[model samples]
Target: MRCTPPPERRDTAFALILTALFGACILLSIIIPSQICLARGGEAEEMNLSSDTALSKLTEGNESPAQEGIPVHVYITNNDNEKLDVSLFIDSELIDHKSISSGSDQKMDRYLLEKGRHTFKITWWDEDVKSSFEVEETRDITAETSVHLYTILNDKPEEYEITVNLVNENSRELEAFLYADGSFKKSKKVGKESSAELGKIKLKEGIHNLSVRWQDDDTKIEYEKTKKLMVKRD
Candidate 1:
């Protein structure tokens, strides 16, 4: 018998090898698409988390809160539903402190302060689940308030009129009231449009308890100042 060349067997082997290669290429294409989708989804999630964190920090004011010298008993109200830390300062130095609840108003007793200008600093802290990872916001509330210096003097009893020269330390408007025998005798607005109340009150010959009250609408209390003078008939 003559040995044939086995051409059919050779052709069958070549076709099987080609089929395996095509199957491998299809599997690789499918896996590549799945990997690319996973990567994009992960990146999107990270970007969203970063954006949310940035917005939360920005909507809140500046971090690292502080303030300078402010007035004594100023009205402070917390309009948000968060705890607030309040610090009182005198000439940029920390002195007293307090905490206020949300949606509540309270007054500070600034009477402990000396006669000078001061500032108040307030800070808001985020309620942290972990104390180490907390954020804070600070704001400085200013008060140009100062003690009113006033003195009621006779100048000269013979002048027959009380001379009340008011020297206001602050830029705000000042008012003076003359009280005699428990009645408001006279009142005048002083400072800037500075005024003088002369020849308005006539004196009687006796030791009179003349009370001079100086007050400003910005302050909480009336500055009690008094003087006694004896009148002599000319």
Candidate 2:
């Protein structure tokens, strides 16, 4: 017992001990970094999944009914014989301008509006005509409505020249007679998709009686319309 172990045996034992310790240190260095990497990867995946779910919810909310608006349809027409250059305005803001020919119609693009009262303005070049309407609530998310505008020329500018227009919207032909103050003035033949005009009549400046008589071809019935005209010198 007092004698020391052999050098060879001692050296071999020490070499084995050192080798075991080195292997343990190398295994610990690799395993610790691997566990840390796994933890970080899992956290990153969870964060990305949460972000995608939030984006999906936000997109669905935007497409919901509570975020939608109302829809409006507007139609404009020029019933006069002259070409019309007009502008459309909503709430005093100009939206569009168009040039429409005689007896032609123009439809504006469908617009989205908030629920409430609004003012629509139609300007014929420099002249102005403003109209007000309301948009009511609907059971659906968006409400649909329509408005029509027609420009009619009904004024006399001179004593020697007078213009009267008769519009025929029926499917049958019509014969229109014009009378001023109980006297026959002129006659015009107006058919479907056409208009009749009685121009250049000699009349005095005063309150006068005006009458128009037409026969309906489809119903074989006669209709008469009478109005009072006041001619003034310009």
Using Cα atoms with residue i matched to residue i, what is each candidate's TM-score against the true structure? 0.27, 0.35
- After superposing candidate 2 on the true structure, give the runs of residues whose Cα lies further than 4 Å from its correct spot: 1-67, 126-142, 154-156, 159-234
The whole-model lDDT of each prediction reads 0.45, 0.58
Which residue pairs come into collision in candidate 1? 65-138, 68-119, 69-118, 69-119, 70-118, 70-119, 72-110
Model 1: residues with Cα > 4 Å off, grouped in runs = 1-165, 192-195
**Count of residue pairs whose backbone atoms collide, per candidate:** 7, 0
Name the 10 consecutive residues with the lowest summed lDDT in model 2.
9-18
Q: Which ten residues in a row have the lowest lDDT in candidate 1?
A: 9-18
Top TM-score model = 2
lDDT of 2 by residue, 1-234 (tens): 122112220001000000334234334333432121224533632112233443354346445365456887777888766677777777777888789887888996777888777666676732322332222222222357766666665333445456777666656566777778788878877776566665557666777777777766656677767778777776
